[model samples]
Target: MNDYTGFPAAARHLAAMIRCPSVTPDTAGTLDYLEKVLAPLGFNCQRVTFSEAGTADVDNLYARLGSGSPHLMFAGHTDVVPAGEEAAWALPPFGAEVKDGVMYGRGAVDMKGGIACFIAAVEAYLEKHGKPDGSVSFLITGDEEGPSVNGTDKLLQWAAGKGERWDASIVGEPSNPEAIGDMIKNGRRGSLSGRITVHGVQGHSAYPHLADNPVRGLMDLLDALLATPFDEETDHFQPTNMEVTTVDVGNPAVNVIPADATAGFNIRFNDTWDGDSLKAEILSRLEKGAKASRIRHGKDAPVNYSVDWVGRVSPVFLTRETELVGKLSAAIADVTGRTPELSTGGGTSDARFIKDYCPVVEFGLIGQTMHQVDERIALSDLDTLTAVYLRFLEGWFSGH
Candidate 1:
């Protein structure tokens, strides 16, 4: 039997990447460091940069080893959210400092650790079984924490244009809530964000009869939106939820009624509906509520408002592919001695974009400290996750 000592520790690679501070929308030498690491592992690396009109340009890395059927692609993001204040953390966020068997850094668990472990596993596999029986690729992006306009979604298209076909994929997105093997995201809830604007005439607050008060219209519209439940529950998902994120008038004067009022909301939904169906449902509710949106007590006319869908709409998806789900579950069980739950409870991820091409699941390190003030991950857990990934790679390629 091959032992775990065949390759260097995963933490070494993780620390190297953490020191780069690859903040969202900025390469910041992260791609450079990753390419240098991957090239030595026999991967042909490509750095693809994508740009949208308003969003900042993002650089992504795609690397592949071998070219054959049953290609297994590992996807993740190298960019991390800002670390707030360096003085507030026990160790400097970009220092990658180790203390008492733990490593502290911004992307420690959210997840440069997952990336490191997967790479180490691949190295261990090569040291044990020679070149992989199938192909392996890395789809690392730098725009996951930003607007996500030009990261994995574009890299996938760029790769597809170059004739890359993937059989299955695993996104390392810190799927585990508490423990490394506790959860695997077989699917994700869809996300729909929209803005509701109510236009009214500006006037003096004392002369309420002459001018419409947009604030009243805004409250009524938002109430109608929140009054009803989107859905009770789905077979594999939680109930659909809507949260009103912000309501703004941007008016400072207390005596003047703002001419316009706007409210923003985001909905996390399930496979019982798609983007179109969910959007229609929301609009239907808004229209029905608009009838009661009266600025004046005697006014019976419905509110004049519009709904604008923001950015791209992610459709809810569930992976019913038995081969992909079964083998991944079995591999996690074999390594962790605990069966992983197939869950679809998190926010939207690049997996939504990946699902359009091939079946993708998510598994990674525990994320208790992700994006927190003093983010860190245990070194011992890092070793254990490396073993888990190594087992999965072997089992996946074994044609089971």
Candidate 2:
């Protein structure tokens, strides 16, 4: 077997991956390298490319070791965000340098490190337990850090089209906050975004009666949106919160009032409401604000405005499969001696798409340095995570 054949090979695998510089939407031959590593291990690897109307074409990989019941899938992406100003990094961003027993690179903790650990775990599992009774697969994509249009969502549909079904999935995202065993994300909240535009007439600043300033109307509408909370905290989720991300008038001149004003806001909601209900609530608030005479007391007409929902709504989801959660939790405790907190307190991930196909959870390396300057991972953390995954694999296939 090649040198990177078993559990101890994780760090080497990660070093090779970090050297690839596979930034968003570009695999940079990372998948090619992965295919070579998994093929000799009896995995049937299929490389697939997907494209849409305006999104970039993305390359994805699906590799399986067996075909049977209780199929377990490992999902992740190879893509990393840009390594801004490489000169600012302590080591070369793509050099995969190890200093003080820590590997530094762009994708070290954000994800490539997680993938490397899982690879080593699988290698170690096979070395000890031989072929698993059921199946194990890797569902990886290169478009995760980009538009996401041609990533896991499309890859899952494509796999399902070929009659692929998973009993459970583990997304190797950076889930831990402070340490390797800090948390495991079992659910994600729903997300909705929109832009509200208020219309008015253009006029010189000196002519107060000649123009209807949309800024005043926008303030009224914004006040209404924030006047009430979305809901109280749910059993498994925090209270729904909305933030206005941007306000734009697009007028460069201070002496002239702009013809229109727009504000963009996003809301992360819990089970208290779905996409449709949340939209209705926002519209209702805007109506109430428009009709109020506090800002435009002299104008009897309501504010002229419209709203546009942005992008697709990511529905909230929680994995309820006890066996899957219990076994993984046990595996972590076995290796780390700490009970991981089951959390649903983060932003969405590709697991949001995988949830529609099978129950999914996320666990990986600490995320303190992910997407930041000098991104790196402790060598000990890498080996620790690998051990956790190996234990999970052994327990999962044994139905223990």
Clashes of 1: 0
lDDT (tens digit, per residue) of candidate 2 on 237-311: 999999999999999999998889999999999989999999999999989888883335587788899999988
Residue 353 displacement (Å), model 1: 0.8
Candidate 2 residue pairs that clash: none
RMSD for each of the candidates: 3.2, 2.5
Clashes of each: 0, 0
Candidate 1 segments whose C-alpha is farther than 4 A from its true place: 1-8
- Which residue segments of model 2 deviate by more than 4 Å? 1-7, 293-297
Report how far off residue 358 is in candidate 1 (Å). Answer: 1.2
Kindly provide the TM-score of model 1 when superposed on the true structure, using C-alpha atoms.
0.96
lDDT of 1 by residue, 1-400 (tens): 1122433569888888888888887768878988988899899999888988999989899999999888999999989999998899999898888888788999999879999999989989998988888899999999998888899999999999999999999998888887878999999998999999998889998987888988888898888888888778889999999999999999999999889999999999977788999989988888888885687678877788899999888888998898888887888888888898999997888898999899999998997888999899988888889998898899889882
lDDT of 2: 0.91
